[model samples]
Target: MTKSLKTLLQTMPKPLFGMGAALGLLLFLMVGIAGGFWLFDRYNSPPLGILESLSEEVLDRDGNLLRAFTTDEDRWRLKADLDAVDPEFIDILLAYEDKRFFSHHGIDPLAVLRASWQLLSNREIISGASTISMQLARLIEPREKRTFTAKFWQMARAIQLEQRMSKREILSAYLTLAPYGGNLEGIRAASLAYFAKEPTDLSLEQAALLVALPQSPEARRPDLYPDRARRARDKVLERMAQSGTIAQSEVARASGHPLSAKRHDMPQLAAHTADRLRRQAPKDSVHQTTLNADLQQRMEAVVRDGADRLGTRLSAALVLADAKTGDILAEVGSPDYVSPARSGWIDMSRALRSPGSALKPFIYGLAFEEGLVRSQTIITDQPVNFSGYRPKNFDMDYQGDVSIHDALLLSLNVPAVALLDAVGPARLMERLRSGGVTTELPEGGDVGLAIGLGGLGITLKDLTQLYTTFANRGHSTILTDQPRSSAERQADASASPIPVLDPVASWHVSGILKDASPPRGAPNLPIAYKTGTSYGYRDAWSVGFDGRYVIGVWVGRADNSAVPGITGRTAAAPILFEAFSRSGLSLSPLPSKPYGAQEQTLAELPPTLRRFEISKSWLTNDSLPEPAPKIDYPPRGAQIEMTRTASGQVLPVLVKLQDGRPPFRWLVNGKVLQANGNRRKVAWQPSGAGLSTLTVIDSAGRADSVSIYLTLP
Candidate 1:
C-alpha cells in the first residue's frame, strides 16, 4: 500500500493546493495595489486650500452682472453652472484631467502605472489622471503639506468623496475650485474675468481658453502670454476633437481665432466700479451690476474722444444708472486702461481728478429738496467774500439778480457758492451722503461760494448718484447689484412719466432744479442737464438726466494737468448728448403741465416786442421762406453813406432781411461795431490800410465780418 499509494498521496488534496494558490495570488495582488496607491500618494500631493468658501455673485435685471465677481477687495470667485457651460469645455477638461472619467469609479489604475513610470524616469509630471470626484475631494480636503504621505491621503480622501458625491456634484466642485488666472478661481469667475461674460455664454474660442487654463493658469494667461495661451488653447481644442466633444471643423475654426481675451480686456471703469461695489455689498455675496455693454462702449468712446480733442493726457470717468432701481448701467474710470505692460493698474473714475462745478447740482438740488429755493427765485450772481475766501464765476462776469434757474443753467460759481452757504455745508454733506455720494469733504471747512461750484473733490460716481436723485424726483433708492422685485422696488415708472416728488414745496424745488438745467437748444427730450468747469481749466463735468436714466461725465487729465480751453459744456456735455442720442431712447415730451401747478409770470415782456418765427435762410438771404423773395446782401465792397442822426449815425446800407433775422450790425473793414437793434447799418469812417473789414455781433454770439476792400482810387 505504501509504494502504490505514494503516487495517490501526492494528489490527495487537490482542493487544498488550489486554495493556497488562490490565497497567494490574492495577497500578491493586494500588496501590488497597496504599493501602487502608496506610490501615487507619494507623487500626487493635494492642492492647497485657497479660498475659504465659494464666492457670491450679483446679477443685473436681465441676470447680467453689473459688475463681475464677489470678493473682499479684489477677491473674485465663481462656480460653473453646468447647464450654462459649453459641453466642449467640460469634455476638454475631462480629456486632460481624467480621460476615463465616465468609466472609472474615481481612480484610474493604468494612469497610476504610467505616472509612476514617468516619475521614476524623471520626465515631466504629465499624468494627472484626476477624475472629477478626485478633484472634488482635493478641493474639500486639501493637503497642508505637499508630500508623498499627503498624496496617499488625498487619494483616499478622493475615493471617499467619490462614494459620497454624485458625478454632477463632483464636476461642479471641480469647476468652482479650479484656478484660472490672477486671483480668479473657478470657471465662472474665469469666464467673466477673461470674457466679461458667463460660462453659459462662452463662445467656442472662449471655452477652449477656460479649459486650457487649468493646465497652468499663470503660464497660459491670455493677457500676459497670449502666444503661450494660444498654443495651450490649440492643444485643448485638439484634445476636445479627439474626445469627439467638438467637430474637426469646430477645432479648426476655434484654432484660427486670435488668443485675445476681449471679455477679460478688463474694462478699467467697470473693474473700478466692481471693486467699489464689492466693498459696499455683503462680504460673502456677489454684487450684481447693471452694466449696459452697449452704453458702456459708447461712454468710453466719448470720453476718449474728449481727451483726444483736448490734447491732454486726460482721463475721464462716467457712470450711468437706472433711476428706478439705482442699478449702475455703465461706468468709465479713465481715458486709457492698463495694457498688460501697465501691470493691471486701473484708475477709478470716481477717484480721478477732482470734479469741479460738476458738484454744484447736488448743493443746489439739496437746497431745493429742502424747500430753500424756487426756479424763479432771484439769486444775486455778484461776487462775495466768505471769511476772505472769494469765489468768482469762470468767466468772472457778474449777472446781478439772476433767477435760480438762470444762475444754475449758466453754472455761475458765485451764485452757487452763495447758495451753498445759505444751505450750510453740514446739511449739504448729509444730503449728498444720503443720496449715495461718497466724496470726502473738508471738516469745519466753510463751504465757500465755490463749494456750490464744485470746489470739493468729488468723483464721477458722486455726481451720477446726485443726479440720479433728481431724475427720481428727490427720492433715491440705494444702488443695488441685484434686480429688485416689484415688491422690493418702490414702483415702476413708465417712460415720460412726471417725477414723484412729495409736498408742494419739494415739488417746487424740483421744478427750480429742472428749470436751472441748461436749455438743450434742440427739441425738448424730457431731459435735465447741467455743465460745470473748474477754475484752473483742469476739469470739466456734465451731469444730466431723463426720467429713465441718469448720466454723469467728467473730462480732465489723469494727472490733473490743465486743459486750457475746453469747458464742461463743450467737452463733457456734448459727450453726454451723444450718448443720449445714440441710446435711441426718445425723450418724453415735456408734460403740458403738472397737476396742482400754477404758472408764474416773470418781468413782463415789452408790448412792442413779439417773438416771430422766421426761416434762417430769410436772415442769411440764402433762400427765401415760402411766398417770400430772397434778397441779396449789400453788394460786396459797396460804399455806404454815413449821416449823423440823434439815435446814432444813420449809415444806410441796403441789405436783405427776409422772413428771418439778419446780422443787425453793418461792419466796415472787419471792425465789430455795436448794433442798434436788428438793423444792418454801419456808422463807419474808412480806416487806413487793409480796406475796412466790418463785422457784426448778434445776440446769440454769432458774428459776420466782411472786407470792404475800399479802393479809394
Candidate 2:
C-alpha cells in the first residue's frame, strides 16, 4: 500500500506470483507423502520370512546319504549353504537372476528404473527388477496373486531380510527354497534327483540346469519336458558367457551335453538302521551313525546270497562289531527286508531263541574259573542221570572217557550238564546276567540243569555281547550303532571296565574252541568260533571272533518252525567264516597267555582235577579229603511206607546219598543191592514187608547203614 510496495509490484509480472504459489504447494504435498511412507515402512513392515523348513537326512559316518525324508509339506526341501554348493553354479545363478544382488541392500533402484523404462518404451516386461533377496522373500511368504500390493509387500520383506541376514545366508535361502518341479524344493534335491550326485560335485551342464529350473519349474521339468528344459539351461549358459561369468569354451561344452531325461531314486541303503536312528533323533535333520557304508553293503550282499541257497522260509542275520570299542560295524537284520516268504521284516538278531551249544563255552569257562576242571582233565562221557532227567549226547552215542577239551569241542551235553550241576545252574545264569547278557527262563520256571543244554531263551545280540568278552580279554561293553557324542565319549572314557570272565578263564575257553574243526571245504580260520543248533533245528547259530572283531551269524525261520536239515555246523559255521573273510580287515592274532594262567597237561593237574567228578563239595582243592557218606532217607531205625505206582504195582523204595568217594557200594540185608558202586541214589524193590537193612560203603572201605521196617501200600 506504500510507495515501496507499489514500485515492487510494478517490476514483477502478474502470472509469476501465482505460478510460484502453485509450485510451493506441490513441493509440500510430495514431502508429506514421502514422510508417511517412511513411517509405514519402519514400524508396519511384514516379517522377514527366512526360517524355512527342510528335509531330514540320515547319513553314514562319512556323510553319505542313507535315506532322506520329506519336509512337512511333502516336499524334498534339503538344506543348502553357499559354501556347500558349487561355486560355478552360484556364479551362474547370480549372473542370470540378479547381477546387482550383492551391491543392493535388497531391491535394486537402478534395476527397477531400467525395467520401468523398458516397460514404458516397449509396452512389455523385459527383465525382472527383484534382486535375489527379493526373490527369496517371495519364495518364503509365497503369494499366488501377482498384484502390485503383493509386489510391494515382498519388497518390504526383502529389505527387512537383508538387514537381518548376511549375503551368504540370503543366497542360501534362495538356493534352499527354490523349486525344481514335482515336490523337489532345493538345489541339493534337484541335483540328486536329476543327476544322481551331490551339488558340490555338479558338472557344468548339471549346474546350469539346476540354476535355470527354478524360473519355471513345471514347464521346464527335465523328466517331462526335456526339450524345454534343455533350452532353458542353454539360455542360462549363453547369459553366463555373455556376462563373462564363465568361459566361452565352458559354455560350449555345457550346452553340448544332453539333459537328464528322468529323475533318479534317492539313496536308500541301511534302511532299517536309518529308520531306527531317525526315530531316535527326531529333532535332528541330519543323523550320523557309526555304520560303515561299504562294509554294510558287502555284508548285506553276503547275507542275501547265503539266504538264497538256504531254501525258502529261511533267513539269515549277521552282526559284526569292533571288539575293543563295541561299535557295531555292520548289522544285517535279515537277508532280504522285503521278502514276505522269508519273514524278512523281522529283525531276527533281536528275536529271542535258544542258542543251542553256543552256550557250552560259557559253561566250561565258568567251570575253569571255579577250578572244578581243566581243559585237559578227563571227563566221563558215559550215560548219566540227575534224578530222572538223563542228558544224552547229540548223536545218541557216548565216548567212554574223554578229556574236557574233547567234551567242549564236541559239545557233549552230558559232561556239560554234569559240570553245570556241580557249579549249580543259578550260579551260571548269574554270571551271564552280570556280563550284560539277558537270559530268559521259562515262564515261572527256576534255573534247571537243562538250561546248560540250551533250555532257556536268549537272543543273538546278547549272545554276541557275551562272546565279545572272550575277544576283549574278559572285559564286557555294550555295542552301539550311533556315533557317540562328546559327552558320551567322555563318560565312557572315565567308566570302569566290566568284567565278564577272568582273563585266564576266557583264554582257556578260547584256546580250546579255536582248535575245533571247521566246516568242510573251508579253511581253518585263525579265529575262534562255536556252533549251536537248537532243539528241533529251530535256530542255528555260529559266533566267532579274533583279537579285534566279533562276528555272529544266525540262520533260522522267524516263525520258530523247525527246518529239518538245519544245523549249526552245516548251516551257520560256513557263513561265519565267510563273513569274517569279507570284513576287509586283516586277521588279528589271539591274546597271549595271561600271567599266572596254568596251561598244564592232564597228568600235571592236581589229583582232584586229574579226573572230573561231580560232588556237593566238588569245588574244594585236591588237598581236602572226601566227605563221609550219609543216607538221606530211613534213619538208623525208622518205619517207612511204600506207595503203589500208576500201574498198580508196588513202588520201589528210593535211597538218596550225599558226599562219598566214587564207586560207593550199596547193600540191603547184607546182600549187595547192585554191582555199580558209584551210584549216589539207588532205587530198590522191596522183597517183603519186614525189617530191612540199607548199607552203603565207600571205596575207602568205610560203611554206613540204616535199618527200617517197610509196609507196602
Residues 54-129, model 2: lDDT tens digits:
7888777787776788888788988886677899888778888888888999999998999999999999999878
TM-score of each model, in listed order:
0.57, 0.77
Over the stretch 110-151, how does candidate 1's per-residue lDDT look in tens digits?
Answer: 888888888778866756655567667666676677677767
Root mean square deviation (Cα) for candidate 2: 13.8
Backbone clash numbers for all candidates listed: 22, 3
**TM value for model 2:** 0.77
Candidate 2 displacement at residue 67 in angstroms: 1.9
Residue 570, candidate 1: Cα error in Å is 1.9
lDDT values of the candidates? 0.61, 0.81
Q: Which stretches of candidate 1 lie over 4 Å from their true place?
A: 1-79, 88-104, 107-161, 173-269, 274-294, 337-392, 399-404, 413-444, 447-450, 455-457, 480-525, 558-562, 582-595, 603-713
Model 1, position 38: C-alpha lDDT score: 69
- Say which candidate scores most in TM-score: 2
